[model samples]
Target: MNDVQIRTFQVPGARLHYEVRGTGPLLLMIPGAPADAGALAGLAACLSDRYTVVTYDQRGLSRSVLTEPPADQDVAVFSDDAHRLLAALGDEPAYVLGNSGGALTALDLAARHPERVRALVVHEPPLPELLPDRERWRAVFQDVYDTYRDQGAGMAMGRFIATVEGDGAAPPAMPDPSQMPPEALEMMGRIQGNLDHFLAHVLLPVLRFEPDIAALRSGPVPVTVGVGAASGDGVPALSARVLAERLGVEPLVFPGDHQGLATDAATGAEIIHKTLA
Candidate 1:
């Protein structure tokens, strides 16, 4: 294993923080919602020996600062953030990996800016397009947004977290919003803002943005779709399957649930490393 160096770079107006490790082709990891770059710490360490792993705190998360109020917090903005980060790092056409919402952004980047991404590994993106009942999913997301606006961030987050954790019966008893650790609360607050933007700007547009299944299937770049083995027959895994089908490719299996890359980082890294090798 190599010692990793954590570095911060200024992206014109925003300060971006990233950890760089290893020495090979660049592999950028885009983290999902409710997590920062630290989520990929273990995975970065695991791949540090063979790959130049770069994981960063996305804008408005943790160490990264939002220079201006986001013009729009849609997937396009997220993809632009990624584009800037990669450009700042002097990395182009690199291997990009993203999970869940991060995957959504990566896919958009791959489709919109193919020249910047050499390959893309998407792990169970919760894209509404892949869902059989898109309206139902939209309703669910809307309900969550409404809950946040009406009840408050904490209550809504608790319910949202529970739903993600496979407990949709009722909202869990969450940490008191007022008493939460400053950092955790900050992240939660950003998440809440992102939730608002997602529902208002991204969801409907994304639902309509058809993934170029043919482009993905025949694009010059290599593409891989994977799902966590532990996700069972849930939406995440099902989404992965559908994506694979659409791409006319096979779906790869990883280690855990939605957060598998973080939870079983080492194993997940090895799987990803093998796939990208």
Candidate 2:
């Protein structure tokens, strides 16, 4: 990614760290959960040969620093940041790929500004509000925050991961939180810092948000909602299917689980390229 350039975008009280690469049409990739722009580096490099892949740290996370006390975590603000980035990068009607929470942001962006989006590819967005059993998932999500408040970050995160992943799977591959391995301990510290923001500012609001189906239905931008092949029973995969159905289309199956964009970049990028093509 020698051609990749990193820059900052200034919003009201925050500064965003974003990277741009490749030479073709702009193709923005939005990350989800606690992931920063770095999470998308492998995938960005994978797609840079075909499109100018853009990724960034969302505000109040990683390098996107906020200048004031934490405030809005509404999807609209995230969508606005994306809108500004596209205009600043000299691309209008750009192609977009959003994974997880980022996918939700892309949906908001496309819905509010159709003229700025060429086509949208959303993979495994965790939109509980769209699901038939939304209340169940909502309770589970809140339980994560309660875990943090009572038990601690590690337990909170482990539960959160398993809750979304479903099937009683997640978190064992990394060094056990109780073991305190250097990398694992360090990662846990970061998670502790981000967990509060994610729970109070980001995840809660996003969980409660209701997408405007009427707006999305009448919108002109083409959208391809996809679910991870491995996340069949997970909340995010089910949410993707529900969202696709709401939009009068089927959710395409992609390579891995909810975090596939970061973990399976190569295969995920290829699948995205085909969908966008």
In every candidate, how many clashes are there? 0, 0
RMSD of 2: 3.1
Models 1 onward score TM values of 0.82, 0.90
TM-score of candidate 1 relative to the true fold: 0.82
lDDT of 2 by residue, 46-148 (tens): 9999898899888888778898899858898898988988888884689998888888899999999888899999988888888888888889888987887
On TM-score, the leading prediction is 2
Worst 10 residues of 2 by lDDT: 183-192
Provide the overall lDDT of each model, using Cα atoms, as 2-decimal numbers: 0.73, 0.82
lDDT of 1 by residue, 96-115 (tens): 99877778778877877788
Instruction: Score candidate 2 by TM-score against the native.
Output: 0.90
- The C-alpha local distance difference test score for the whole of candidate 1 amounts to 0.73
